[model samples]
Target: MLTAAIVAILVTMVLALIRAFLGPTEYDRMLAANAFGTKTVLLIALAGHALSWHSFLDVALLYAMVNFIGTIAVMRFFEYGNTRDNEGSGSTP
Candidate 1:
């Protein structure tokens, strides 16, 4: 069961990679990247269980935190970027 899950995750990760590369918009690519990271975490957790390793869960947790922060940061950047472009760079006197 664990092996099957790991394989499924690997397939999803590949699909995410393809989307990240071929996505038509920046947001689409970002979403794909986030999905890949989530799948990676699941893969690590499952692999660790299958292999009887103790520290992989911790690594997965760390990766998950990083992925969450990175996604938020990227979303903020995109959101503010559009507003900045529309609002202009000139300071009000």
Candidate 2:
């Protein structure tokens, strides 16, 4: 059962990678990257169980946090980091 889950996740991850590459917009690509990260965490947990690795869950959790934070950061940058509007003001501050 675990092996089957792992294979399914791997397949989904492949699809996510394709979406990341071919997505029509930045948001779509970011969403695909986030989905890929989520699947990786699931894969880690299942593989850890199947292989009897006791500490893998902790690593997976940490990876999950990092992925979430990174996605948020990128989204924020996309939303707020564009300085082109400020460039026209000619104010040096």
Candidate 3:
């Protein structure tokens, strides 16, 4: 069962990669990339179980957090042209 799940996830990840590369718009690619990351997390968990890896949970959780942060950073760049917020940009004292 776990093997089947891992295979399915890998298949979707490949599809996501294709979308990321062939997507017409950056937004579409970003979404695909995000999906790829999510699928990776699932794959990690499933594979860990199948392989009996004790540390898979920790690794998957960390990777998931990284994926979330990376997606947020990419969206911020698209929205603000940078990661840093320009608070109180009226004038610098």
lDDT of 2 by residue, 20-52 (tens): 999999999999999999999999999999999
At residue 26, candidate 2 shows an lDDT of 95
Model 3 agreement with the true structure over 1-93: per-residue lDDT tens digits: 777788889999999999999999989999999999999999888888888999999999999999999999999888777424456466563
What is the total number of backbone clashes in candidate 2? 0
Question: What TM value does model 2 have?
Answer: 0.89
Q: On a 0 to 100 scale, what is the lDDT of residue 25 in model 3?
A: 91
What is the lDDT of every predicted structure here? 0.93, 0.96, 0.90
At residue 18, give the lDDT of candidate 3: 100
Runs of candidate 1 with Cα error greater than 4 angstroms are 82-93
lDDT of 1 by residue, 1-93 (tens): 777898899999999999999999999999999999999999989998899998998999999999999999999998777565556768663
Superposed Cα deviation of residue 36, candidate 3 (Å): 0.5
Q: Which stretches in model 2 have alpha-carbon errors above 4 Å?
A: 84-93
Candidates sorted by TM-score, best first: 2, 3, 1
| Residue clash pairs of candidate 1 | none
Of 2 and 3, the candidate ahead on lDDT is: 2
